[model samples]
Target: MISITNLSYYLGSRALYENASLHIKPNQKIGLIGLNGTGKSTLLRIINGEYQADGGTISKAGDVTLGFLNQDLLSYQTDDSILSVAMQAFARQNELQRQIDELLHEMETNYRDELVDKLGKVQEEFDALDGYTVQARAEEILEGLGFSTDDLQRPLRTFSGGWRMRVMLAKLLLQKPSLLMLDEPTNHLDLPSIQWVEKYIQTYEGAVIVVSHDREFLDNVIDVTVEVAGAKLNYYPGNYSFYLEEKALRNEIQKGAYENQQAKIRQTERFIERFKAKATKAKQAQSRVKQLARMELVDAVIDETARVNFKFQFSTQPGRHILHLDDITKAYGPKRILTRADIRLERGDKVALIGANGRGKSTLLRIISGSEPVNEGKRQLGHNVSFSFYAQHQLESLSVEDTLLDELKHANPTKSEGELRGVLGCFLFSNDEVFKKIKVLSGGEKSRVALAKVLLSQANFLLLDEPTNHLDMQSVNILIQALEQYEGTYVVVSHDRYFVSQIANKIWYIEDEQIKEYPGTYDEYEWWMEERKEQEGNSKSVDRKPAPAPQPATTTPRASDDERKEWQRTLKKLTQQAEESETKISQLEERKKRLEAELADPATYGDSKLMQAKNDEYHRVKAEISQLQDEWENAMLEAEEWEKKLA
Candidate 1:
């Protein structure tokens, strides 16, 4: 329905696109992918006419409606109810509705022939436009995007930023334009909302162009992939996986050609060098030089940016049982989230927490991380456990006044400047980027910084909530690789099925106020769910009764009074040990900070003997700090376990 012929665009001195062209056909779903700042959004804006291309012709079919979901908020609806905002998408239908009503009112009052004829005509138009069902359709889309019935009446200003984005998305979906352009439509959506969008786009009659970091969503929705790199656009005939395979195949062929060309050039150069002065080879040498000048060199197929290289460094190894939750329940007044949820996590276990929106996946992660208290539950951290948490909103904790480098430096003041820069480099911040303040960073940049902070902490356990929310595919893959290699236990709550499948060995599915554990990967869990669904359908057909519940197991005998008293002493001793260990860790960190400061000085490097001595002391202090941290965590975990037993 739309075509771009010889399109060219520029951002100041940078050429975002040069003679790039592509055609978008009706009912085609295209995924636009590139690194950050590669003009994915810029190209969308150009297509939407928000920005004119430097030199390009974007021709559209006559009377084709367009809906572009950029960051720009819809105008003049901040105080309106969400339903009212969505209903406005059907302005033509609303007008038809009004005309029909007017004609009916006129016919009822005057009973004239002209009024009756006009009423019939208006009703026909309204019926053709589906005006009568617009309200119901709007409500359905809202509900699919995770809004409750009551939420339809609430003003848009009452919702959080993420929820408000959903409201805008609902309006766009309701509009159902001929060409829909969505830029990161899945950024703030939960699993159910994303699924709704996936299904909607798959069945949508119009064409769609989306720029998303969500690999799995794209794989399910898009039929074509447009890759923007190196000031050029490449089209893949299939989805993301196919794009990968196809790109590799093309690169291999290009590489072979490049190698052959280089070999011929080398042979020509050798002949020239060996016989340039001889009369027999003069013409050939000149011919080879001309050929070299006329040759079109092939650019090496390499990543535009460096991949992240880092891993979670653990100071201590937790016990066999990493965590245990007994009879856990959580509720907010009348709305219960989790009920009697009992779970045991073992060391080295990677669990993916999956559930619908508002179904307690994040709530469960919070409860395990001890950031939120359970209404009724007894939980214990195993001995030597030390953990870090990354919440979806964790980026909000960054200081606006600090630069990216400063914020990371504040986390570990003892880290040398060079070491800190190395970590930042792994996260893709370098040169002047390190000096950019947190307030100026984009959401994805902030998320990357938050993640880098989490990785730098020496924790044996990781509790992540929507860690991939704003990350690009490259960053997500980097994280997946790191987590896959991590030696500690982790429980991640993510809606990215591809990422979850890459990292999780087990699945913890939350539904109906209960947690169900599946002992397999995400793909396996999907198969298991499908099989169970089939079994249930067959049983329903047979009209059989449900099976009986199993009998409860017998309890172990209680401990004697002397044993309990010894446990009390042990708890007291552990508490004191924890306090002492913390003090030692603090002392070491202070000494390490001094050593790092000394190392930062140019004068210290000038004296080789003194530099070596300080460096030695720095290494010793770092190793000691790691040991002290392990001791501290071990003491704290043992104390918590003892307290649980005594209770």
Candidate 2:
């Protein structure tokens, strides 16, 4: 457990955190969320003791170990295999292992009672520490984080920065310290790897504090929300979704208090103006003036929720069909990416391209954008179709010496400065920020610049690769709004499920070296895929053998009439039991949904005891529903058996 009391941190003359207080309990899962440049990562570093607080105190036990997985770890290079690097988390175990090995080697030459006793003690400690299984455990975590089993033997230096970050993540996760801190852990992870990490974090015994922009990940893995705003750390007793609702409620209260105080100030000023001119009520007016001076002002709540109003102007509307790829075959050396893949893009399709890493989603986007030539395919562009491509690598292409205004001006020279400024404002760059050089911008800032450029391209079609990367929740929302208003076709490749679910009208994935399309939203696509998988599993499990040729039905005393009647009755009873169980599950599900809605209310969060009680009830209802569903399944199976016996 750790307690940060009245913590203050400053960046230059600006206060990043002022009198911010937060109590972190043991095993508490907290999501540290805020807009870009709000010092979420700085707080993490402060907690990890990389930086000292300017004021106040951070108190924790001496033995409370901290495991930090940060972007700086990406630069850590080692010739050691990734497995060895991850295994290094077990420092004491490794040293014990060395001692045991040295003792065994010495024993080969000289075996003594003291040496034997030492060997036994070391071996006992090793086994107790589970040192023998450390390598396997490290490999499992690395693979879960997206490394292949073969990749475990590969040198850590050989991987890209993203993969290297994952190796570092695996190392920290394996360490399993008293407190685990991850900053933007999902930035380098694919969907599967993110999900795996989510599951791991949800069950981890150690406390975790994560600074992430991924909404769904936070909702799934974090129970507490700590927001950095107005140089203060605000605590919410629930997840991100609850925090949103709770913040709205608190904002409403603040708005009312602010309005009341302003009205009182105006009334006092009027009284002072009216009576100060006269000698009769001068003392009372002066007293009111003093009262006004002593009154602490309530800060107005500024809505950080962003909406993009800038229309993405295009020169011309593309034809009904934007582009088409027929029998596309793409390969790099012996490694094939796509084989005979066919895909069609329509004029107004908002498509989300999602899949695991190494699946060539970017390669496919490049091929579609005509930046990459296909080895074998017919790539056709519809009439009057123009496209702009945005990728992370495009940030490098930006003129670093150019100011933000200059960058936008270079992107579209025809647009007036006023018009460009308006568009930049929509992307959260207003006034003086537009003059900041592109080189000095953060990754999220650079991403916005790139996205703004794409919008300014005057192209009818856009190919965006991970456009939501490095963006905060507000920025992602702005993008979602911008894409919704844009009158064009775009296929965005992203691992952000929440963003995809919001903006995507259709889903695309790479399977069997072919681009596949699902004509629905991401949520719908997931549902359909689950159903398809279940059906496929059932088909594979079911025997496809031909039925035995039916001989003339022989009554041959197979069963007595009483026996048949009894079997039918048993089947009916079993079916009835299953139906009752199903009904109970449905009721519990509705109850659970109701509780969830109530739990999201700010009033519920105000009461810690009520919050804990509701949470316990919610999870209990979930377990009850699961148990009932399983029982229903067993009952159905029994009913089917009875029916078969009757037949």
Top candidate on lDDT is 2
> Which clashing pairs does model 2 show?
none
Model 2 residue 326 CA deviation in Å:
1.7
For model 2, the superposed segments whose C-alpha errors exceed 4 Å read 540-647
Local error of candidate 1 at residue 638 (angstroms): 14
Error of 2 at 437 (Å): 1.7
Q: TM-score of each candidate?
A: 0.80, 0.83
Clashing pairs in 1: none
* RMSD (Å) per prediction: 5.7, 19.7
How well does candidate 1 match the true structure in TM-score terms? 0.80
Identify the leading candidate in terms of TM-score.
Answer: 2
Summed over model 1, clashes come to 0
- For candidate 2, the C-alpha RMSD (Å) to the true structure equals 19.7
lDDT per residue as tens, model 2, 462-507: 9999998899999999898888888899999999999999988999
